[model samples]
Structure formats: structure tokens, C-alpha cells
Target: MKKSYCPIDTFINVVKGKRKATIILHLFQGDKRYNELAKLLPDISERMLTKQLKELEEDGIIDRKAYPEVPPRVEYSLTDLGKEIHPYLKGMFRGGILFEKRIDESL
Candidate 1:
């Protein structure tokens, strides 16, 4: 991740990708396979999901383990850094809910 003067900017830069935060949230629940994540996030295209996962791995937020099997199995789980950021992400999730509620109420 690029260094930023503000810590918040650094944090935002780490997760600034389509469904990246959502993917982390799901992985926070437990280790998940590629297909499991795909099911959890139906709106994201396979290509986008793959890209996001690769980026997250590169950023040291998530670990991808590949198992040698007939079809090849891969699982994703949060790294120590990823777990450390959970509360912050959770707070953002809550804030998003609040804004969404306001939007719905206004409509």
C-alpha cells in the first residue's frame, strides 16, 4: 500500500476496491473457499472477485492457501493485520447502515 500522510487515508487505500471490504467481512466470519465467497457475494463478477482476492493477498490482509487435489482447492482467511482492522471495518459497516436507513426513510 502507498504511504499516506493521514492514517485514515492509508486505511482507505488498503481497502479501496470493489467488494474488498465486503470480502474481508465475510472472511472474518471464517475461512472460506473461492466458491463459498462467490456464493456470498453474488453481485461481483468472477474476474473482479479474483482480482480483489489477489490484491488483498498482496496487501498482506488475507492469506490464500492452495490444496493439491483433483480439482485444486483454495481457501481464504484473514491475516493478523486483517483481524486487527476488523473493528474499524465493523464501525464503517455500522455507519453505512445508518446512512442507508436515512436514505430509505427519505424516499
Candidate 2:
């Protein structure tokens, strides 16, 4: 089947996945290394994390910088466009917390 990459669906494509948003949410705190990101989001496979990072970089939502050292180091952080979405992400997080509380209360 052919997948449609519509303009309206582009944002969802980038931000609506488990690993993708998890990566973005954590990085809101600061830059993160590959292993640090993997540890922070332990459920994600390293391959998935790598793929998501590349996608985000291609979309200009995140920047990856590699430093030369004995073992080499790479860190990922939000780009200006990514920072623009942080407020929305914060609100989403707050809303999710409230929704979970409501579910707990009902249970």
C-alpha cells in the first residue's frame, strides 16, 4: 500500500509516535547522548532510537552534533523549530497527568 505524506499529516508523522515524543520530551531538559537517551527511554530499541533521531534531524526538529574524543561523543538537542513546540508539549504532559488522575479517581 502507498502511504500518503500529506501536508496536514506531517506534524503527526514526526511527533505522534512513542519514541519520537519521548525523545523530544526528555531533551526538553537538556542535550542528551545516545546512551543517555536510550537509558532515559528504556523501552525503546536502540535501532528505533537511532532511526527516530535521524528522522528528527532530517525534519530540522533536532540537531545532532558529534565531537571528536577518545571514544567520540554525540549529543542531540532541539532546534529553534523544535523549541517552538515545547510549550505545546508541556501542555500535553500536564493534560496527560490530569487525565491519569481522573482515571485513577474513577477506578
Which candidate's lDDT is highest?
1
Q: What TM-score quantifies how close candidate 1 is to the native fold?
A: 0.97
Cα lDDT tens digits, model 1, 1-107, are 78899999999999989999999999999999999999999999999999999999999999999999989999999999999999999999999999999999999
Clashing pairs in 1: none
In terms of lDDT, model 1 sits at: 0.97
Please give, for residues 1-107, the per-residue lDDT of candidate 2 as tens digits. 12347854666666876578778888888999999999998888888889889988888889999999869999999999888888877887899899999999999
lDDT (CA) for every model shown? 0.97, 0.84
Q: Model 2: what TM-score?
A: 0.81
Task: Give the per-residue Cα lDDT of candidate 2 at 14.
Answer: 66
The reply for model 2, stretches above 4 Å from the true place, is: 1-9
Please give the lDDT score at residue 84 for candidate 1.
94
